[model samples]
Target: MNVLLLNPDALRGSDPAYPLGLAHIATAAMKAGHAAEGVDLFSENCPETAIFSTIESFQPDVVGLSVRNIDNQCMRAPIFYLETAKNLVHTVRKRFYGPIVVGGAGYSIFPREALDYLRADYGIQGEGERAFVMLLEALEANSKAFSFPGLTRRTADRVEWIPNVPLASLEGVWADRSLFPPLPYLDAGTRQFPVNIQTRRGCPMECIYCTNPWLEGKTMRFRGPEDVVLEIRSLSDNFGIARLTFVDSLFNHPTSYTETLVDAFLKARLELSWECTYNPRFHDPHLLSKMHDAGCVRVSIGNESGSNLSLTALKKGFEREHIERSVLDAKALGLETVCFLLIGAPGETKDTVLESVCFLDELNPSSVVVTLGIRLYPGLELSSIAAKEGMIDPRQSLLSPAFYLPRELEGWAESFFLDEVLPSHPNWTV
Candidate 1:
């Protein structure tokens, strides 16, 4: 069987992320004795034509589309990406007559709904490396009643989703490097193409508006630290890429594991400068020092809110002091710190917002990202709160974003952030 993996993500406002997940699936498919190819639309100037040409050239038996993000996730100026995905699906269907399967972080968040919305024939939620291979084998056998985890089938009336997939072992899972975007970083000027690497999957933290726990189960699954080093080494040796960004929901959780990985990196002397999202709850200066010594240049702390009232309201489990100490420790080690502040969550008022801004001012992170409102996803506590407040229908397909912002804060939040907060703090961005 021949498979074509397509990455339809072209949002390049920030650093354009490579389709690492699709590459993993493509590699898995090839290792299973099937021919696989990938078409990355991220760097394409003409995506529609490129898709048509790829289909004409590859003529794959199955097409897998990886949807990385649903919306920009910015409540102020949200850009929904599913319409572009839908158009891409339509284009592919018009050109090719094979099955279309959807996967990736965005699709995994709303598998059934996304499959239906994109009008794809099937979808594999969660990890797709093993499940995708199983799906291909089942399809090759012309077997129906797909019983694999993460597999979903769509019919005329309804979409049937299989059980969520267990965490896949990273023993031999790797993305095909040859299919990656070309060098010189086209849109991202002067920014080194830091390859995105995932050392683990799943997040245990249950933020009120998060889909990580739902998309990837509450339990964390880690790849061997040695295996991670080997992957990084391979990418550096083969592709001349040294910079890496660990895309785990929270990379430095389980302090012991993180310290172990850091020690391994230092022992290997890989000369790889990497970064990751850090959980501020565990503020260990020793760990921060080790990370800096092991070539960690930056860390992003998604503290969400600096106000304890908002933090407790969001069930973040950490208070302002944790964030402050974490930032101070990282700065002491000369590591660039980026703190994420999400204002306008439940229990957020003008005073709480001010408290958060003042806290950020005191912490003095290298950079601060502020988002105005919480985008509510279905099946989350925020969704229920929105329902209780008559903000949205609980049963509504959140495929289209529905946000949870207090009525009183409306018209005030946006301007306050734009005019007052952002301008006052040179480091702040919305």
Candidate 2:
């Protein structure tokens, strides 16, 4: 079987994320004796013609499209991305007659809807490496692959989704670096950001607004510490890529796993600098020290709010004190700390928003990223709350843009930040 994987993400606001998921699928499919190639649309000029030319040359038996994000996740200026995926599907169909398959972080969140909307023949929801290989095998056998876990299909009347079995082992699944273009050059100040690598999958945190639990499962699974170090070393040696960002939902969770990985990195003595999203609730001096020694240059704390009222309303496990300590402790360790805060949640108001701003002033991080409204996902608690509060119709498809912002705080949260807090605190941005 010949498979051509397509990465349709072109948004470069942040660093151009290496298509890690597509690379993994390509690796898995190739390992199973199938010819696989990954083409990043962002890296190529004339992407539309590139797709047609690749199809003409490769003549693949299957085309797999990876959708990284459904949207920008910005409530203020939301950019819906399913249309892009749909366009890619149409582009591939224009020249090729093959089974079109789709999967990725964005696709897994709403697999059935994405498949139907993109008009693809199939989609694998959760972990794509294993499920995708099985899909190829099933296709080769001319048997039904829809029953396989994490696979979805559409019929004339309905869409069917196969529940994925939780893959606990990270033994052989790895991202093939050669599938992507060489790492781009960055200046000294921003060079710390590099291509992303994942140490694990899944999240246990039950933040009300988060879709990580729905996307990656709730329980955490980790790659072996030595395996992580080995992959890092390979990246450094083969590609001269030293800096990386661990794109895990939460990096420092399950302290034992983090400690082992950090220890491995230290023992290997790799000249590396990295950053990760940290949940402040698990901040420990020993762990922080180990991470610093292991070349962790920065910590992006996922403390979404500075006010306890908002924290409780959002079901953030940690409180304001936890965030303060996490920031102060990371700063003390000489690790640059970046704090993320959400402005308008369920209980957000003038007083609570001010309280959060004041708290940020007290424990000043290296910088603060403030987002205005919470983007609502399909199965999250925030969507339920939105429907119950009459913010959106219950029958509405969240596939389009939907956000949870208090009606009372309408026309106030953005003004307050842009007018007062942003001016006083140069470190804060929306």
Candidate 3:
């Protein structure tokens, strides 16, 4: 079987993320005695023409499209990414008569809706390494037994979804970097783009608007510290990659594992600069100092809101004081700190927004990112709140981008951020 993996994400941003998930699936397919190829549309100048050309050239028996995001997550000017994905699927269908399977972080959230909207043959909801291989085997044998974790298929009447099960360990699992070359992604822009590496999976934190717990299960899984260090060394020696970004949900959680990983980096003596997102609840000065010493040049704090009222409503698990201490600690160690402020969540008001602005102003990190509204997905507490408040229909499909912003702050939030908050904070960006 010839398997072609396509990355349909073309979202413009500061960096072009290498499709690590697709590469993993491709690698799994190859190891299962199948010919696998990967094409990334993000680096292409014309994705439509490129999709047609790739189908003509590869003539794959099966096509797997990885959907990374549903929208830009910006409420002020939301770009629905699914339209591009659907068009890509249409192009593939026109050129090739093969199974089209969709999966990724974005598709996993709304499996049925995304599969129906994209009009794909099947969809894999969660981690695809194992499930994808099983799917390939089934397709090859022409077997109807499609029972597997995270597999979604369209029946004659309705779409059926099997719940996803998180992998218990990441011991021998590794992504095949050869599928997607590093130079094209690295040299896409003038700003240095870091290669991403995931040291762990799963998130236990229950933030109201977050989809991490849904995409990845609540259990925490860590790769071996030595294995992660070896991968970093390979990136440096083989690819000449110096910068890295750890894509873990919470890099510093379970402080013991983080300390061990840092120690392994020190022992390896690899010269690489890296950054990761940190949870303020696990703020520790000593561990942070060790991380800085271990080639961590920057840290991004996931402080959604600096006001206690909004923080509690979001179930952030930490308070404003924790954010302050984390930012100050990272700053003291000369680590570039970036703080995130998600405005217009539930319980957000004039006073709470002002409190957040004032708190961030006093802290003064290296940079601040402010978002106006929270993207609502189904089965979230915020979605229920939005429905109860008559903000959205309870039965509405969120495949199209829908945001949850308080009515009280609708006209006022955008103006306030533009006039008062953004004008004063030179380091902040919306």
TM-scores for all predictions: 0.96, 0.96, 0.97
Highest lDDT model number: 3
What does the lDDT come to for candidate 1? 0.84
Cα lDDT tens digits, model 2, 313-384, are: 998898988898888888998999998878777878888888888888788889999998888888788899
lDDT of each: 0.84, 0.85, 0.88
Query: How do these models rank on lDDT, best leading?
Result: 3, 2, 1
lDDT digits (tens) for residues 1-430 of candidate 3: 9888898755765456888888778878898899987788767778778878877888898999999888888899988888989988998888889799999999999999999888999999999988998889999999977689989997667899998888888886677687776667776464346889889998999999999988888999989998898888877777888889999999999899999999999999978899999899999999999999999999999999989999999999999999999999999999999999898779799899989989999999999999999999999999999999998999998888889988888979899889888888889998
Answer with 1 or 3, whichever has the higher TM-score: 3
Candidate 1: worst 10 consecutive residues by lDDT? 181-190
- What is the per-residue lDDT of model 1 for residues 58-156, given as tens digits with 9 covering 90 to 100? 889999899888998877788999888888989899889989999988888788999999999999998888899999999999986668788888999
RMSD of each: 1.7, 1.7, 1.5
Give the Å shift of residue 397 in candidate 2. Answer: 2.3
TM-score of 1: 0.96
Clashing pairs in 1: none
Measured with C-alpha atoms, the lDDT of residue 358 in candidate 1 is 86
Clashing pairs in 2: none
